[model samples]
Target: MLALLPLVILAATPIVLLLTISTERRHALTAGLALTGLVGALLALPTAAAQAPRDVTVLLRVDASGLAYAALAIVAAACLVVIGYRYVGAREANPEEYYVLLLIATAGIVAMAFSTHFVSFYLGLEILSVSLYGLMAYFRRDRWGTEAGMKYLVLASASAAFLLFGMALIYAELGTMTFAGLVAASPEQMSNAVVLLGLAMLCASIGFKLSIVPFHYWTPDIYDGAPASVVAFASTAGKLGVFAVIVRYFLLPVGAVTSGLTTYLVVTAVASMLVGNLLALLQTNLKRLLAYSSIAHMGYIAVAFLAHGPVAAETVTFYVLGYTLASIAVFGVIAVLSTEPGRTSDLDHIADYKGLLRTRPVLGAVLIAGLLSFAGIPLTAGFLGKVYVVLAGAQDGHWFVLLALALSSVAGAWYYLRVVVAVCSTPDGESALERPSVPAAPTAVLAVLAVAVLILGTYPAPVLAVIESLHR
Candidate 1:
């Protein structure tokens, strides 16, 4: 019973907030409610972990691995909500509905993290996707926001369709939708064309969510157009939930026997790494550059994911948490530097940050750490993540993928250094260095994330122990 408490709290919080919160309790009070709920859910994780490795229902499993990822999703959600207080309050928008959607989306993320059956997985994915549609277009007055939301709706819906069709195919072949059932049947059904095709279709949708190659068309536009706060949530927590599902699915016995699926992932991982980094080099728009960078980072995560070795799970978990910390810190800076509420972001261009170090030293330092982590620089979380992923690849004997990761890191450094130089250089004009008002909530969140990145990079043993305990 205690194992399901966090989910109960998450699902109930949005409903209670929607019902009880008055219009007078607009942004601050409503955001406070959401924050309290997320913190409560996070607090419940230890209890959930205590009773872990137990199946709570036909659909859900309470376990260390799921709880760890759920914790990551909850933390990311909390950071977004904390930052949203200022962003939503300043905009000409309905703050109550924003919190409602955010809470609901968070519930979906938690559901995905805990899911063990296809029914729960499909339902969880839809809940998160639908809620995000509203959050992405929260600023209805901005054409960019509305347009981005619509594009996401269309593409995401199409991906969901592929996912459903794939599920149907697998069910038709094996007469089961449970992960355990699928694994049990794989030895006999692995050769079936229907099962193979079904797996392909399922992977296609996951590719879109992670913004891997070929299916990643919507990432840059959506990231560029959405509010920075929403982008942070989607980029961090959104990916956390989806990847949780992917990791669970792949670790099952069935994944080992499906040669076609393994081949498909290898190709996609390599392509995403090379293509994503190459495209980022051509971008001047800060949001778009980060969008492309996310694609590449997804590819890096995949390296650890596909390894399926003894340390593979631990490697993936550490790398994921590390990446999330770096991402939230970077976007927190973007959220703080945003001058106008509903307008297109002020930190749009690379040139916009000239002399930022002189004007806003703290924000500049945080941004540098975040970007360097992305580039896999030494003494940063991102570097540790890359090192782990590479070690996993070596353990699995995936030489081609390892080579791709190494080459892409070099290409990634060039673009990241460009932004660093822009931040430190003299202002191009008087207008360039004028410091924006730094909101306390977001600034504090940025500080926390920066410290977390450093801690995880320097002393990862504690986190590694937690992840090791979670691994099946």
Candidate 2:
């Protein structure tokens, strides 16, 4: 119960601040709330890391996997505070509601990390999804933002319906909603038709969250319409929550049915990799490019889930850490650089970035580093992350999976390199767009993220060790 305090605090902070703070001081209130949440999470770190697994209830538990995910969400939220400092302050819209929604969203993420039952999972997911509807359309003056929000709302609600229906079916068949209880019940207890149909629906719901192919229509539009800071939050933090739940649901009590699901996941992952990267080549907008890239990256991480072993867990965690850092660094830069009054993201066009090195060398360098990491260039964290996934898949005799991943990597290099080319290329003096001014906090955030990415790329041993330690 004590170990769960951090989650409680995280969930409470936003609501508390929203009620207590006056509108005039909302900015400070928001930052203070986030800071409180961060401190609470940090204080719980040692407990979460050292304590044994404990069941809070039949439907929820505290364990190492949840701890890892909670920590990631906390860190990502802290980064959001820094990156959003100026954006929140400068905007003319109501800052109070914006920050309140952000805190609620963060709380929802933490809840998702700790959920152990289908009911709790659905509750956490809806909390996150509902908050995101507001966050996506925070800039209501913009038609694109409102349109994106509406689309996300419709798609997300439909997915939720599918998920709930699946859960009802599973409960009907197994007579339990708790993960442990479900695993304890033999497959023979349920009708094969019900099990298959429920699992397929479950997959569809999660696929929508993960932005996998056939269910990824909302990603590009939402990413392109939201502010860069919000996009960053959605891409990394939101996906991490979904991945945490997926890993827990798939990896528990390892069995034949889980194995079959893993096979399906592998096939979907391969398709996402090829389709996401190839589609990215046609996008001129940076947000859309990264949106597709995110789908591809999810596919890369999905390969680890297909492997199903201690190595798979470690691989997924390491890959997620590297990918999240790269995303934060890239999006942080975009938040700062794209502060134009009306734009959602600065990496709007390759042409817009020509000669960026001359005016914003630090941002250019960070962008280049991030791009290289995404491309899995040697000696980068991305390289090690990719290697782990490929090795894990190959160990399990997933040959076609390995081949598709390799070819996708090669194809991915084209668009990633195109960004690099634009960054390095010199443009005519008059044609060069003047580098926009960025404030101190966002710049500091980018600097920290850049350094983190570089350090992780060069010396990934410590992070890998932490991931490997979760095998127990």
Which TM-score value belongs to model 2? Answer: 0.94
Tens digit of per-residue lDDT, candidate 1, span 1-472: 8998888889989987887565365667788888999999999988887887889778999877788888888889899887767767776556678888888888898899888888898898899999989988887666788888998898789889988999999999999888778778745696798988887888898888888898899899999988888888898888777877767766666345366656876888899999999999999999999999999988898788767734767888888898899998888777777746455543678888888877888888889989999999988889999998998888858999999999999999999999999988887666444755677767788888888898888888887887787775
Question: Least accurate stretch of 10 residues (summed lDDT) in model 2?
Answer: 339-348
Candidate 1 regions exceeding 4 Å error are 22-25, 253-257, 341-346, 432-436
Q: Runs in model 2 with CA error above 4 Å?
A: 48-51, 256-259, 341-347, 427-436
- Which candidate wins on TM-score? 1
Clashing pairs in 1: none
Q: Give each model's whole-structure lDDT.
A: 0.84, 0.79
Tens digits of per-residue lDDT, candidate 2, 210-323, equal 888878887898888877778888888887778777667656775534555866778888989998999999988888999999999989988887777577778888888888
- For every model shown, what is its TM-score relative to the native structure? 0.96, 0.94
Worst 10 residues of 1 by lDDT: 339-348
lDDT of 2 at 302: 80
Candidate 2, lDDT over the whole model = 0.79
